[model samples]
Target: MSSPAPPSGAAPTPSLLRPWPQFLDLSALSLPISLSEATYRLTQNLRYFLPNYVVITLLIFLVTLVSRPLSLILFLCIFAAWIYLVFLRDEPLTILDYDIDQKIILGLLAVMTLVALLWTKVWLKLLISLIIGAVIVLIHGILRAPEDSMEDSPYGSLLNVVDSPGGEHASV
Candidate 1:
């Protein structure tokens, strides 16, 4: 026999096995308007936003990796600032005889990241890594030979020139 239908105007009871129906309402989690509309907007503009977000995230990761020690110090300072602002509210936050506020804490973190990037030479490290990767790729390509003759292969002449002594003067 089929179960009785729910009373009119009452929400249908969700099954215990499918609890997500009760808790994960997309409409409830929407910003100001409809969740579907917001999602549509994001999808429509993804091509414009994704590449910039990826580049910025990669740059931040590189800077953080290069400035490991200083980043740790900066993290600790931010943590201390948080602790002072939230946990130890009874005491005023003071640094170097000046009162420290949210703006000051944020400014300090920004300055620290900038200083760390400069001090660690993140740009120089990035350039070196790129050069090394290119060199490795080139070396691998040069060492791997094709079955075709030097004249038939596209890179054959270039490889021969590089491998041969006094072949620098060879015409293109």
Candidate 2:
């Protein structure tokens, strides 16, 4: 079965999933001419599409964990800790009157998360998925040409692309 075609005059609306439809423009994708060019394009694309890359990596990790219930629970606990201590915290935390540094919390969380995930034995699968995601992002970043048509803009970047009329530069 297939859906009916749209009217000829209608400019088909872009999918909500693709905030910036132009970001995935195939015509803009091409092989870099030189090592320097590749490096430059990779850096630029990575910067510009960092949010998109993050989502891809997250999706990969989530998929890897779906088959392992225990790992999923452990991952959620670790993620909650990070979110509570870092992103959601409005001020420095105090333990026994001595203030705890955010950096220390981050370090400890990183070490603990690694140890816990590794101990779960599912780390291998998650790690491989993450690496694959990184590779895909890197390849695309290197190949996607720097768009000449897009202009620099400060608003509607990353997750806020739809907020502005034309968020040309989601990243610099």
Candidate 3:
């Protein structure tokens, strides 16, 4: 037997359990536009603020080169930058700046992770994590750059591209 048709001008009944529309919306979390925007903004900042990257890298290297207090200070600096970008930035969450400063902090964690692998030194893991994070950022930067663009940026080298609106190098 076939089900009865709905009455004229009456809405159709929705499933008592899960509804199709709700399910589709929930499953759309992996949308590409959001991911690509995130990639663009992230690489933009990383390519722009490479000194911050170097500073963090050197700091981690120093941690390996020196003692504990210096490492903590360097890590704190990295963390402070992250708070600024993630909390204070006006851009939409999906398209916020790439902010490699935070990655530097994570890289330190990676370093610590690396050390942990060789030994039980928890601090060393920071360095290991830092290295891995750097590799990821580098890959993202390369992928984000346009193929036919000559001279990535006028301000700095190919790796760093801080371009001003008037066609000049703004700053590093």
Give candidate 1's TM-score.
Answer: 0.26
Best by TM-score: 2
Alpha-carbon lDDT, every model: 0.47, 0.73, 0.46
| lDDT (10s digit) by residue, model 3, range 68-156 | 55545555654455444443444333326553454565566567545433453435555675895587555544444332223433323
Give the better candidate number (2 or 3) by lDDT.
2
Clashes of 3: 24
Clashes of each: 0, 0, 24
How would the candidate models be sorted by TM-score, starting from the highest?
2, 1, 3
TM-scores for every predicted model: 0.26, 0.58, 0.25
Off by over 4 Å in 3: 1-33, 67-172
Of candidate 1, the 10-residue stretch with the lowest lDDT total is 14-23
- Mind giving the per-residue lDDT tens digits that candidate 2 earns over 123-161? 678779889998999898888887631332222143255
For model 1, residues 61-99, the per-residue Cα lDDT tens digits are 445555566655654564455444644454356689876
Q: Higher-TM-score candidate among 1 and 3?
A: 1
- Pairs in clash, predicted candidate 2: none
